[model samples]
Target: MDLKSTVASIVDWPIEGVIFRDLTTLMKNPEALRESCDIFYERYKDKNIDKVVGIDARGFVFGAVLAYKLGVGFIPVRKKGKLPADTIEESYSLEYGSGTLEMHKDSLDVGDKVVIVDDLIATGGTAGATVNLVKKLGAEIVECAFLIELPDLKGRERLNGCKMFAMMEFDGE
Candidate 1:
C-alpha cells in the first residue's frame, strides 16, 4: 500500500551529503511491514532458496522473516568476529569510510542457492562484499532483494552475479 510514502528520509545522517532512507516509519506500521514482507514472499515462495542471507543489522529484520515465509533457513552475514565459528570476511567501503562483513565458513556449501536480503541498497559496497563472500563458498546467488533503493547512490552498479529486486525506490530527492 504505497510503502514508499511510509518511509522517512533523514538528510545527512551519520554523515554529510547522504540522505538516509529510514525504514523505521514503515517498520512501525503493521500494514506497511506486512505488505513489504508479502511482496517478497510472493516473489520467492516458489523459487529454490536454500537460505536467505541477511546483511548485518537492519537486514536481519526482513531477511529472517522472508526466510521463514519461504520455508528456508536463515543465515546472517555479520560483522567481523561476530560469528562464533570460523569465518570469512569481505572488507568494503562505506560512504564515510571502510568496514568488513563476515559469514561463518560452514554457513553455505557449493551449489546452494540463496537470496541476499537487506533493508536498502545505497552505494552498493556492503552488497558487493556480501556477493563476494557468497561466491567464495561456491554457492549460486539466486538474487538480491531490498525493501528500498536509492538509485542516486548508484549502489546497484557495484553489485554483480545476481538479479536485484526492491519493494520501493526513492530517487531524485
Candidate 2:
C-alpha cells in the first residue's frame, strides 16, 4: 500500500506555517499499521538489536511491537518529568518549537545496540535528543527509524552522522 496516502496532512497545526503529518489515520487502518511494523521487523529481525528505544507517545506504538517481534527490550524516551526514575535529558528544537526529552538512566549499558523509533522526522529535534540520551547511557545506536520524513526541514542533518531510515517522505509544504 502507499503509506503516504494513508497519512493525513493538517496545515498549520501546533503553530502557524508548520504542516503536521498525522499518522493516526494510517495507524487506524489494520493493513497499513501491520505493514509498517512488518517493514521494520523485517529490517531489524537479524540486526541483533538489544533494545528498541521509542520516543514519547507515537514511538511507543511501533517500538514496543517491534521489540516484541525482535525479542528485545523496549525503552521509552519521554518528555521531561514523565519517567519516575533517575533519568538523563536532552533538549531539542522541532518545527513547532523546543522541548526536553528524558530516558531512564539505567535503560542501557555500554555496547548495547538500539534502534530509536518514532512516527515522523520533521525538524529532527526529538530524534536527535533521543539519540543523545541513548549515547549518554553508552548504548550504540543501530539506526533511527521513522514512518515519515520531511526533507525540507533537514531534520536528518541534526542526527550527527547516525544512520536513519524512513518508510515514506513528505514535502514540507
Candidate 3:
C-alpha cells in the first residue's frame, strides 16, 4: 500500500505557510493502521531493540504497538511536566515556536538498544530532542523511525547523524 496517500494534509495549520501532515486518517483505517504497524514490525523484529521510545502523543500510537510486537519495553518521551516522576528534559525549536520534551530518568538502562518513533519529521526538533534524552540516559540508539517525512524541511540534518527511517516521504509539496 502507498502509505503516503493515507495521510491528510492541512495547509497553513497552526500558522501561515505550514502544512500539517495528519496521520489520523491513516490510523482510522484498519488496513492502513495494520499495514503501518506491520511495516515497522517486519523491519525491527530481529534487530534486538531493547526498547521502543515513543515521542509524546502521536509517537505513542505506533511505538506501543511496535514494542509489543517486538516484545520489548515501551518508553514514552512526553512533553514537559506530563510525566509524573523524576524526569530529564531537552528543549527544542519548532517552526512557529519552541517546546520541551521529557522522559523518566529510569526509563532505560545504560547500553540498552533503542529505536525512537514518531508520526512525522518536519524540522526534526522533536526527534532531535528525544535523541538527546536517550543519549543522556546512556541508551544506544538503533535508529529513529517515523511514519512520514518532509524532506524539504531538512529535518534529517538535526538528528546528529543517527540512523533514521520513514515509511513514506512527502517532500517539496
Collision pairs in model 2: none
Off by over 4 Å in 3: none
What would the per-residue lDDT of candidate 2 be over residues 1-173, giving only the tens digit for each residue? 98889999998887888788899999999999999999999999999999999999999999999999999999999999899999888999887678999999899999999999999998899999998889888999999999999999899999988999999999856
State the TM-score for model 3: 0.98
Query: Residue by residue across 49-138, what tens digits does model 3's lDDT show?
Result: 999999989999999999999999999999898999999999999777889999999999999999999999989999999999999999
- List the global CA lDDT of all models: 0.90, 0.93, 0.94
Rate residue 141 of model 1 by lDDT.
92
Clashes of 3: 0
Model 1 C-alpha lDDT per residue in residues 1-173, reported as the tens digit of each score: 88999998899887887788899999999999999999998999888889999999889999999999988899999988789999999999966778999999999989999999999998899999999999999989989999988888888887875789988789959
lDDT of 1 at 23: 91
* Sort order, lDDT high to low: 3, 2, 1
- Candidate 2: segments with Cα more than 4 A from true spot: none
Candidate 1 regions off by >4 Å?
none
Between 2 and 3, whose lDDT is larger? 3
